[model samples]
Target chain A: MSATQSRPEPKQDEVYSALASARRPKPPGRLSMCLTFGWRGMLKIKHVPEQLIDVTLTPVLFLLMFTYLFGGALAGSTSEYLQYLLPGMLVQSVLFTSVYSGVALNADSTKGVIDRFRSMPVWRPAPLAGAVLGDSVRYLVAAVVVVVLGLIMGFDPGSVTGVVAAIALIVVFSFALSWIFTTVGLLLRAPQAVMNAGFMGLFPLIFLSNIFVDPATLPGWLEAFVHVNPVSHLTTATRGLMGDGASAWEIGRVLLEAAALAAIFAPLTVRLYRKAS
Target chain B: MSAQLAIEAVGLVKTFGATRAVDGVDLAVPRGAVYGVLGPNGAGKTTTIRMLATLLRPDAGSAKVLGRDVVAQADEVRSLVSLTGQLASVDEDLTGRENLVLLARLLGFTRADAKARADELLEAFGLADAAGRQVKNFSGGMRRRLDIAASIVVTPELMFLDEPTTGLDPRSRNQVWDIVRALVAQGTTVLLCTQYLDEADQLAERIAVIDRGRVIAEGTPAQLKASVGQGALHVRLLDADRRDEAEQLLARALDAQVHLEPDPARLTVPVTDAGRATGAIAELSAAGIELADFALGQPSLDEVFLALTGHPAEETVDEEEAA
Candidate 1:
């Protein structure tokens, strides 16, 4: 007890030595910071493995349920439905899972991690960019699941080139779509709000388009809206690439929509994220 | 550039919607001195610290940290200064070790150097055992220690600690105080914000008493206590009805401001000399006021706050700040 009575006096001479050991040699470049933030985003998913359930289980279940449940009703056979619905499912799965990027960012912002990153001397946009980069894995996971499940269910792309190009296009589109979610996450105050907003905004885009059915079957006015829908264009582009019916014009249109989305949301997300506490 | 001052500001202001959280504040903190900003929760101490740390831009005025403007040269200021916000800002998903290493790496350390620095900090902070545990699992005190350690991944010349020991037990509080002492011993300029008067008294070489977003008083603790005069005299009346009579007697005899309402039937007045106590007692007896208790004591920080602001520190916190 006597030994604990007296507090230790702090020594003064070693301060410089201690600081030298902890010195920052140089500030990381913007690209390195982006990668670092991306790595952090992935680490969060690793720690909370439940976060990946959306990207993993949802894709498999959707492929099985939609291919079997709607195949006969719409396309006249399960095999025929697989060809039409698999491409749609791929787009839907990636689009849905990409929204989690916003939810996760919202959750992270509520905590102190974002503040720590902002306080650093590194590039300011690195954390936001890294988050999108890290969550891109979810998009990758969704894309793989849909393709593998579709191929196993007796679906054919008609050409390996078409399958590769379509998968590549889907991945790019998901990455672009994630920027929109990132913007929503930045604007919202709570993760639950981001999740709700994401689902509400994405549902209309996915269901109202030709992702699940032909637009011609709708009323004339409804058909017009569906044809102009961005998601509808993306689904059409995917169907063409995977079935040999895709026109260069259709794929080009999808790319332009992705570019437009990135152009608008990327700057907004970065601006909002910089202003985040 | 004034190399002797760690911080210099002129009329810094920040408003939240209709509430002027911080308004027209000025500060000059000399290098190598521990300056404390003492206030109640919503007194705008945290907002002022955030502005100086470059976390929030001020609505008016300007501030410089380590000679760099907080807004225009925020990047340079960030490199030279660090902040441990009122909220511990460490990553919860990462392990204590991983959190430190990640910040070290982000600060431009090589992988091996980052690991080495993380290990050293974990060992120094007595977090070696919990190094492998996720930060989310750490106790409040452990998390606070890690949060502060992360800020020093580079030994910043100036550090801002906003309520560093707010929720800690006495033992943990002492540990944080020791850390602050060590940092100052090594020439780091510290600006600590706290509601705990004793904490500021113990660690700060100078203090500013802030209320309603303005610095109402600024001085060393001894000077602030001295400004209230020699000491305070407490006189309790046996009959509640005679409280006013006793208060009048004391105020007339001592020729000083008298304070009432702190107790149901008590009279508190400032006295410039211990000799005034005798005069006060005689005056009360001459006025036929019986006393239940009588004591004379030196001023505490609480009394200092009361004398300066007409309200105690704990009760003066703005409602918005409390939320």
Candidate 2:
């Protein structure tokens, strides 16, 4: 290196030759592309492990506070409330965690990496699908925290298989719900805006549903709203799976709602994403 | 016809809420050479590039990138072109190596091949040492080098370098120039958008000077410079107080308007005859004004813009607010 320059000369000739000799490989299948983006999301978590703090802390605090503070007053005993409140807590925790899907998308868009991904020849929905897939892992983490804490606090389920089924149902529902937030993310310009809107919309659905108390305990008008709330259906379905058993019709309705959300918002998110810039 | 040209955009228009950022801009960039799109800030350079790259849909008109319609065959166009944006497009949270690997994997490389290519690019760009470090912590130069490396992980027929060296130091800028030259040498057509005149003069064989969403002038660097004047006479004064006196004296002696530079001690006069310039220097000497430096050189791209647009190249216009 000369005194005029501090850095080494870039190996330009070698770079050109490498580019010249290399062949463009076959583009990956859609699934692989989505998974690669999922891997990217996981890498972000690895670099900043604090991304999981909300997933862990939210459930712990919500579960403990709801079960102890209001449990005796509502259900006659903390242990009785734990059995009912734990299933609803799983729904609330996973849905709350789903808000990050939109926040992360907004962050990516603002950072300009979304341009890089969009300009590439990969599947159009791969990035969005992969991000939600990555977030499913967080949903699983939240479920695990809630379930494990419930058991230690004296909540019991009918069977281990039932608990597994219940966790799987909630995770799938959260995955579907994440697309709605991703659409919100694409519509808003800032991550903070997306987070705010996501939670503001969710607070009513989470608190006004059967998560912490029975919908029957409410007035007729409020109960009607809770009965129709998708979060309430998801919570009830989760409770049935983890407790005695839920009806096929009840489980089917939740799956239909999840599917409908994915069907509507996935395409909506992709459209907004394509038109974003 | 499109085979010989890497990009052909005609009357492309893009408006953002009443602001026509790119208005009827047309471009024909030939293959295997650096085609410079030179403009100042908010001159619709980025917007025009975005429309051509298929990142933003044009409000009207059409574009063909590498002989394929950009809108109709966007996937094919994406397959054949890559854009290194003005902003660092790589993931800041990921390590330099991880960003490259991620792009490579997205480009269809196998797991092993992606790592190998990432390593090769990091080494070639002189970023081997910082490969493991997060990109957010890298210097502007390092981030720029990594961004370019990310673009070339799998080479395309054409590359869009948007202000690639905008804020880099001279050494890093030179390194980027070298990398760009290498890419062109290997048959990669580069559409380089830059505000720096010399960067265009050094790298581009043909230059398009766009101002306010239109191509005001298009020619080779020499032709564009010649359009303004044959040459410029630059004079630096020993005493800053005598600049106005020198400006008037030179304007009278040389029979041309003197352009005052931002430096109070310096002024430039566009000159066509060397004999008249010498007479102006003598006129300055007769006035007892000492000279620090004087040189007659080809009109730079800045002067060309000043001549064509009635304003200097550094003068930003209303388009910036929309941008």
Candidate 3:
């Protein structure tokens, strides 16, 4: 039997008649196009639920593994260490999840969809900007999972405002960090390269920082290096805000770092995105 | 600067490192006409289309779509034109209807308007039933139809279809051809780039035979065929033994190179006109060589390309691929 034999043939007149009656209005403005692409990013996640695993499972596994596995050794008990480790894990998980934005963007560029988007008369940077913005949801998810799970694990943030401020900091930082990956995605030829490059570069920054252990306990030279690590600064700021009240100076420095990254890599990603074929 | 011209390009050039993907090429396509760029694979058809569609910046020269410079006023040109690439460029992760709706909304339709426009296009392209199915699950032909539909969400003044039917079967190819005809009938100017000569002959009002990143021959299909030599005359000898004699006799009689075929003992000679076919037939019969078949045939596109480029399109594709 013929494949899909029951499929009916569309009548020629019906097709022509429908096309003739189509009324095309003026194209949407820049913001509308940006929002449309942002929605597409979420739609893609909905279609492929596996993409949610990083934000969902990573928080659970990393929080549980690090808390129970190294909690008693690092501190006196799992519950005591959970307070410090949870905030750091939030920063770590959010950082790890941010790379997927670049991987997704790179994957999208290789598909036929980017060619169609380029041909459209919409805003030139909408797809890139929307992708970066839409990926904020992942950071939000990771942040929420960490906070809710940390509370259940007996890790208290002490105040709602403090938790909100810490999550806000992580999201802003993740948004800026996504630009770095976005630029990489735009420049790289393969999606796999974006992931590999992201992990290889980010792992050193994450592991060598003050996330897992205190920088004060390390040797003088190593402590000095860890003190200067951007991840260390971010994790420290996050812990301060999430635990007690953070100093304005400490919060301002992380914000400055995030703003600097956005300032440099946002324009760079846009330029490279424009040049991508 | 003619008002009737939809697209005008002068000395357009694009180079990729060491390779000049799109060499100095010029084209003048009149409004409401199908202009076909016929070439083999890697002959720069896609590259030229990309430049005209404002997807790639030309290294030299300039092009104007609807009087808007492709470089200086690319946004204006983009607003007035749409392009369906060789690959079906619709998003694969989204459903067919979702893809159309997304493009429609981006093209500025309101939520209701976008949904209505999408429904119309889905039904129009015979994709209404498959609207809910993800594009990755659809067949190639369906995806191609959806891609074309996506491009026309705004009903652009000028449209570029780059090899719209490259890998389609005959029926699906016909469907695409019908769509092109329907678009042209609706007052849209179409610039179609394809390797299939028959596709150009059947659809394009004018054909440009491009090879090695340059237009070697430009004319109507019939005009290009006539440029090679007029028509061809094929004669089949009844006796296999007299194949050589028949070839020699016809070559001398017609003053043309006669190609011999042993399968049917056939000899084909290029003739200037239908009048020359009579002379070849008379001479073949006079030599006591009974003819099984004799007919005057118009030159096919393969012959036209062979005559103009010194190699047929199929052979050129193979040679370039091998290289």
Per-residue lDDT tens digits for candidate 3, residues B78-127, read 88898998777888888998998898888878999889888888888888
- Kindly report which residue stretches of model 1 are placed more than 4 angstroms away from their true locations once superposed: A1-20, A157-161, B229-302, B314-323
Two-chain DockQ for each candidate model: 0.39, 0.55, 0.49
Please give the TM-score that candidate 3 achieves against the real structure: 0.91
Fnat per candidate, as a fraction, reads 0.43, 0.63, 0.51
Question: Model 3: per-residue lDDT, tens digit, A117-234?
Answer: 8877878889988887788887898889888998888887878988898999999998999899989988898999999999898998998898989888999999999988889989
RMSD of 2: 3.2
lDDT of 2 by residue, B149-235 (tens): 888888889999999987777888888998999888888999999987778989999999998889999999878877787788999
Off by over 4 Å in 3: A1-4, A8-10, B229-243, B249-255, B260-302, B312-323
Q: Say which prediction, candidate 1 or candidate 2, comes out ahead on TM-score.
A: 2
TM-score of 1: 0.88
lDDT of each: 0.83, 0.89, 0.85
Most accurate candidate by lDDT = 2
Q: Considering every candidate listed, which one attains the maximal DockQ?
A: 2
Candidates ranked, most accurate by lDDT first: 2, 3, 1
Which candidate's TM-score is highest? Answer: 2
Q: Model 2 reproduces what portion of true contacts?
A: 0.63
